[model samples]
Target chain A: MKRILLTLAVAGVLSSCGNNDTSKQAADQTETAHNATEHEEHGDHDGHGDHVASSVSGNTSVNGPVRKSDQASAILDGYLAMKDALASDNSAKAAASGEMMVKAFASFDRASLDPKQQASYDDTVDDAREHAEHIGTNSGKIDHQREHFDVLSKDMTDLIAVVGSDRTLYQDYCPMYNNKKGANWLSTSKEIKNPYMGSKMSTCGSMKTEIVPQ
Target chain B: MRWLKIAAVATVVVLVGIQWIPTPLNRGDTRADKDFIALYAPPARTGTLLKTACYDCHSNHTDYPWYSRFQPVAMFLGNHIEEGKKDLNLSEFGDYSPRRQRSKLKAMSSQIEDGAMPLTSYRLIHWNANLSKADEKAVLGWLKSEIK
Candidate 1:
């Protein structure tokens, strides 16, 4: 009887230890989530000299990447299809294609870009539509439409580069960086270029708000 | 038993009554546009989109939601808006000077492409602010031109 009781006590102690471990895990996960959420909520606007600016809030639990995963992706696909269709300079097809891209660009998720960068994105979307519509309706050359394509392509390229490189600016600070990969950081190997001047070392982090007023 | 019933009623009353209490509105400070203009000047379409969708939180002047007048929720909104604008303020764009503006635009484009801006939680309620494909192209296109 004594041996049996001792075995039961040991088992009970082991089970309690397991429970404790489980609770610790749960707490850690919750704390990490809480901290991340807090960072996003507060970090969106940390040090501007003006009035209090609110961070653009988002639910990080959504399905897919912070960029390519939403409804905006489908719109991009359709726009690309139209671009391809219009390549033949088929007026009718081009018009239809142009419309698709226009609608797609107009409706692209504005909420995706941060406030500081949102204005430029908006302008690009509008300009691309204007060019596409003009090229589609008129007897413009395919080269002309391709010019607009170049414009759109360039914007997309820049946007991609910024998105890829900007992980460090907000990863430790903004909640928007709460994607599955955690905050994206810069690898030391890459030469940080300045946004204003290509090939300059003025990376995005260089523009951080100044601590002292000029 | 009577005291117990009274206590239950009081608790319910407090819970129900708290919802009725009005919270302060966030009538953000908009006088800081000088800095905003200096730091960033988006091309036409992209600038418009930012003004419409992001200026509320990221700038000095937040539009404020209806429920923002309620406590707790209002507090949450206040903290968020303050934080957002601090990280990047549209109203204070001019403050950054030319070099800073260029860099800011680069950051702006990247954040948009990466789907880190308008914030999903924000879009859930403000449906009009949602960017369709065309909108994305316009904004991104403009940024590309300016950057190039």
Candidate 2:
């Protein structure tokens, strides 16, 4: 009887620990999802400066010199939204975010930048807009969207290089992507949550370059 | 002895038969005179190094080696050329968007720095294409100044 009671108690403790572990994992996933969705429904607004600024408002711009340009920052915001959506494997949201990117790029003012920056802006933004439209057009087709994202991420990195960014971003690369043809993208974090291979190879890429604002 | 004779005959026949198989060459009307090399107009020596190291696989015009006439090697070179061009084609460099050009340059820089490119198999065969340390520094340094 004593042994039976002891064994039952140990089993109860193990089960409770298992439940806690699962709950904690669920909570982490939810938090990550929430962070991604924070930019959701945000694409509808044209007030990109105010929107993008809010997310990256605090420490960097307060003390450090270089600030994100209004037009560039808005584009970055749209990219981040699409990237986060794809990272979470949300094709529907990825499409929506891609649409926002098209709108953001279309509405961006090029005349405001210097001649060199403007030239780069014109080319990179145009290329990125094409990829964004593809992603936007293919609402349920995540694989196709991912193919475009492969190049789009490279586009975004080049854009940020020319236009600069408020956020300290990392240029990440996944060697396993596109039959080892290799693909690259800009990420706001150093963590290896690959947008290219969602879930299957989520932690695939490594940070290759650090992009700190001017 | 009979089995060995049969195997030898089969190998010869297969090799001879495959010679008739047509392979696609990288040669195309899409070749650009205003290529990456042409655009930058690097020093003649630098240009030579680039041509030796890159253009064989990364250009629209791939000068076939003697072995490229062989069936399987021709096919292998064809595939490598296609993949290399897909990544960064000098002939199509002018056609790529500014972002793409920069990205390709960056890719080249990384590949060179990390020693991931010139693909060991390629370097083993095309010894002239091997990029020495000084060659790497000069080419990458020029690219860094240009890409930005």
TM-score of chain B of each: 0.74, 0.92
Judged by DockQ cut-offs, is candidate 1 incorrect, acceptable, medium or high?
incorrect
Model 2, B49-130: lDDT tens digits are 8899888998878878888879988888888988777667787788876566655675576567668778999999999888
TM per candidate comes to 0.37, 0.49
For each candidate, the DockQ is: 0.02, 0.15
lDDT of 1 by residue, B57-116 (tens): 888677777776665677677777877875577777666534345445655666677686
In model 1, the runs with Cα more than 4 Å from the true position are A1-214, B1-25, B28-44
For residues A1-214, could you state the per-residue lDDT of candidate 2 as single tens digits? 0000011111221222124477744543444334324433344121122122233323111222234544577778888888888888989999998999888887777777889878867887777887787689878878768877876886776576566677877666555565544456678886767788887767755554455664
lDDT of 1 at B65: 72
Q: Residues A32-130, candidate 1: write the lDDT tens digits.
A: 355445545444321121011121123321111223233344334544454444433444554566666667666767786778557655544444455
Compared with the true structure, model 1 gives a TM-score of 0.37
Candidate 2 stretches with Cα past 4 Å from truth are: A1-214, B30-33
